[model samples]
Target chain A: MSVENSDLLKTPLYSLHESLGGKMVPFAGYLMPVQYPLGVMGEHNHTREKAGLFDVSHMGQVVISGENADQWLETLVPGNIIDLKQNRIRYTMFTDDNGGILDDLMITRRENDIFMVVNAGCKAEDIAHMRATMPDHLELTELNDRALVALQGPLAAEVLARFTSGADEMDFMSYGEVEICGAKCFISRCGYTGEDGHEISILAANAEEVCNALLGEPEVEAIGLGARDSLRLEAGLCLYGHDITTKTSPIEGALQWSIGKRRREQGGFPGADKILGQLASGDIARKRVGILPAGRAPAREGTEILDAGDNVIGVITSGGFGPTFGAPIAMGYVDLKYSAAETPIFLQVRKKKLEAKVANMPFVAQNYYRKPK
Target chain B: MTTYYSEDHEWINVESGVGTVGITDYAQNALGDIVFVEVPEVGDELAKGDEVAVVESVKAASEIYSPVTGEITAVNEDLEDNASLVNSSAGGDGWFFKISISDDSELEGLMDADGYKTFTAGLE
Candidate 1:
């Protein structure tokens, strides 16, 4: 599956990553930085303790507007787009008619439009899906002139405050329009690294300047996709192709919480039948659960899960060494009966059945900023 | 003792008939952080190119191949407790295992220090 270099796309910050000694690799049809000189372990640790900067420019940024935009969005997704308060973000997935997830994404209801950040690999298909099903009144526009970046960790807010106004005041999932280096930017108090952080979307032309300013901060270090992946895994977040796929349902993926109560009952979204059916019956055959391998061996994805009796129960979807937890952690689908915390299980790695246990997620505790009511 | 390198980025330092084996600095840097290592049992006989150990980083795993046909003499117990030793001292204390070389002629096929340096240069 090696893609030709000429065929691969480059993000606006591609050269910057190279200049910083980033290891470039092909990802989702784009040449991306997999890691930097700091290495995955160093970068992952830096992001948890201090602020780490990331280039998420490859993700799809889109805006949907026109008459009944919010309601129309609900028809496609399970999230309650109509009731979403302005400047608030919601995590949701695009599901197929069979209740399988097409892609997971973030949606923010803006003053006059709904802004979305879809997975890079799924963005084109998602847009085509919407365009095919959308009514004439709704207008969907994919933003090609912008770049997205994430500043994550305990010190993120402090670093972001110096460049953007009022960012320190925003709560988790709050969105605001701010200026950085005189570039109009959309800043959101959210991220995937299980840390209190913010993701800023700015013009592609100003990306380098804004990034240089943020990286200039003493607390911020340049992070690559390597750390981004491990951080998200430790945070118990899903990676699109690895953790959740078109064959997995939102319920089985442990993302039922992403659906809103109104959407759950009103049931206008795709996969409503099977999704609501599983919700009502609570008889899902399999559920995504966290697995803690008993030893040092990391049970990678596709490692089969076995019960105490040696019965093949399920398979691992995402597995890696969690730098913060200092152990091998994984998330996988298992028979609902074996999804309980502390349930003894085995992982088939290299023909050996390694002992493991079903554990709760977020191996590293999340630190999202929340305001007191 | 003399050190020899393999195209697989592993180094085997031979002292008499026994050899101490570990990955090179380039392999460690390419592999990122070393989190876990699976070493072969002492008494196992392996052929040249046979997998001797499995080194795992946070992201993925790589297999360390035997440079020459040999019988495993001893394993690196330090790696079981502190795999990061592979990253900290890949050439010294971080050695993976010791193998009693069965065929001295196989050593001629492996790369010497200077040749290995040139081979690694071409990779970049």
Candidate 2:
């Protein structure tokens, strides 16, 4: 279906994807490619073996600046924003008044401003909340016309380095501006796939040209949302809506590391008291884990997770067959008792019980490149 | 020969005393790329319109239903590892299984090739 006629919003790369035989679907209010001609499994394995280019332009990119940008942002999030050096990126979370998570985002301190990229689905609400809460002196500029592309996989460095010199010198979580294909853009040495990759944020006008330039390289192929999901899953990353929400706490979701020690002790940000209490006392239930059906069956989202006696413990958030693993794998929450790795669990698929296990995440190892200090 | 189609998009071709089953081309196209197939074991008895097997693609999974009452006499074991055969040839080499017809009289209820085409046309 054409993007203009469809109810879903269109990204700058929508036409490019259609020309390349991408099967479009509605995602986060945008018409995106769910899979290309290479298909989902092929794309999934390809990203693991080689570099995959993804048009993540739908994500919201905003720049916050002012004399008090750092201090103001620190009040809204739990990250150590004041300690972030120039050109450094930090993964952070937005919490509610009760310490419930609102969204997860990546914050980078540019030379003169703080740049943040948030989930596309939550952009509207995030922007509105920030505007209403922040002081008028703090300027929040939404880069709505910009497009972002992610080149992820083990071989991402080699291919990306050809375009931007000294890209290999930057370590994971570092970012810098570089000129590529005759356009200046911000490149961050980070990605959702848990691989040694980069995310390039460029002007929307240059999006198509940049994508085509990358695709012209022999090692790079356009990936779709299908591979994007599995890649993040294999990386053990959480999807915001599924793995995290306003109702879920960081401690309960196993994301204690994102909360700074000072924040936990000082008790600032939303719901800090409730979240800190959970950290000290512990959750009544834990967001545990589960594996795939040992057989050929693929356990999908919303499937019921059961214990030995057919009692419900948790629900599957993201479950599907992993092409690289050659078996089905999933992640979900369970009772604290059954949350341990290798614990046996049963997934009710239709009329039969499918055997599964509580496997550790990153189902595959992450290969991020970090420079030695 | 007569044919029947399931709502799940599988088709059954019945002859004098035997029946052959496979998924429809429309089903294969909607499924994107086929990666795995779970055919029923030989000698398994099936009721009309029973879920006899499963087909998995990169994006989703679907159940394949039997179109007639029969006992499975043969299954295409090759598809277990090479499920792409269904995407390439959904009707011919992609035939999922062969059944020893339990009721030859049931063939009268199925549609012919032309009738099946007309039935599917209504779907789109």
Candidate 3:
């Protein structure tokens, strides 16, 4: 696409990124900053050690308005929307008739509406699905003109708190509207890097101003899709296309917890019966687990996982050398028998068989902030 | 003294019977930041164009091929700890290995400095 056409779909801070020497790349149909002059590793380490500012504007933001929006949305998702308090967010999924995952999303309840953020690549399809099933009274408004920025790391809270008062008071998964740089915006204490951070929603017009304000801070550095992928992988978060797809179910992906206990028993949502049956009878043949490569060689996606006798069991979904761990890590699905922590496995990297072991999720410790009651 | 370039972008500076090898500046720039370098073991025999080492960037991993048939005499151990040196001095101190040439005539098949410059110009 032409630059203007791409910028037409640009998030709020496109110009700001270009001004800072960011190399733009087409991602999810929107032009996004992939890295800055300092490069990906610099940004990756900066986020792990301090804070990394990311313009995740490509993700679709939508507001589900009208009465009973929560009740109507609950019918389509497996989360318990009725029990979800105001300003609280929950990670959820939409299922197909066969219990396969259609999309994974985040749902937040407001006083009079429900807000959601879905994957950029799957936004159009997800909105269409929701609109078809939603009650007539509910209005689905896609906030295409809004920009989303994610400030992730241990110091994210401290850095963002400077702009938004009472930011520290907001606990994990809680969100509220606040004024940042004299512009009103929505701030949520949530992130994908297993760190204590915030995702800010602002008007596209004010995106550059707000980004510049954040970048002015010494602790905050611009991060791109390259480090974003690696950080999320190290955090054990699944990428939509690679880790979870239309054919994958929450149960097989180790995301059963996303389906609330009440919803599990009621079985009203799509593929409810199939998913619930797997939960109860444990019929899933394979499960997703973390893989730590024995050496420096990274076994990338599509690499085959082999057993002792070189029997192919599963394939890697995402694999790379984790900058923080200083070693190669991956996530893949293997037969239940070989999915246990510390189970020996081998990844076929080219003509070589690299040793690996099934390990626990979040190869690094998660740094989320939870408030004590 | 003479210099040669491999198709895979490695350059070798030969003096006496030994050759010092490293990736070219163009290769390092194209690869972006170097995070890890897997060096071949010293004393390993390699044929021309054999995959002897690996260089990993943040986005992808690539194999470094041998420029000429030779027995590896030494390797740059500093790269194992500070791989970024390749990005800073790709054609100088970042040299990967030194090999005792098995056949001096193999250099005839490689590109000279000017030829390499012309070759990389076409790539851009």
Question: DockQ of every model listed?
Answer: 0.90, 0.50, 0.44
Runs of candidate 2 with Cα error greater than 4 angstroms are A1-5, A290-292, B1-8, B35-53, B65-85, B92-94, B97-124
Kindly report, for each predicted structure in the order presented, the TM-score of its chain A compared with the true chain A: 0.99, 0.96, 0.97
> Which candidate leads in lDDT?
1
lDDT of 3 by residue, A204-238 (tens): 88888988899999999999988898899999999
Q: Ten consecutive residues with minimal summed lDDT in candidate 3 chain B?
A: B29-38
Candidate 3 residue pairs in clash (backbone atoms < 3 Å): none
What stretches of model 3 exceed 4 Å from their correct place? A1-9, B6-8, B16-20, B38-52, B65-85, B97-124
True contacts kept of 2: 0.42
Model 2 Cα lDDT, one tens digit per residue, A1-373: 3445467788999899999999888888898899898888778888888889999999999999988798888888888888889999999888898667789999999899999999999999899989978888889999988999999888888888898888878889999999999889999999998788899998999999988988898878899999899888877788999888886788877888887777778866778788888888886467646465667677777888899999998888887777777777788888888888888889997767888888888788888997889
Docking class of 2: medium
CA lDDT of each prediction against the hidden true structure: 0.92, 0.85, 0.88
State the local distance difference test value for candidate 3: 0.88
Candidate 1 lDDT over residue span A43-159, tens digit each = 999999999999999999999989788888887889888888999999998889999889998999999999999999999999998898888988999999999999999999989
Residue A23 in candidate 2, Cα distance off native in Å: 0.8
Model 2 DockQ reads 0.50
Which DockQ value does candidate 3 get?
0.44
Candidate 2 whole-model C-alpha lDDT, 0 to 1: 0.85
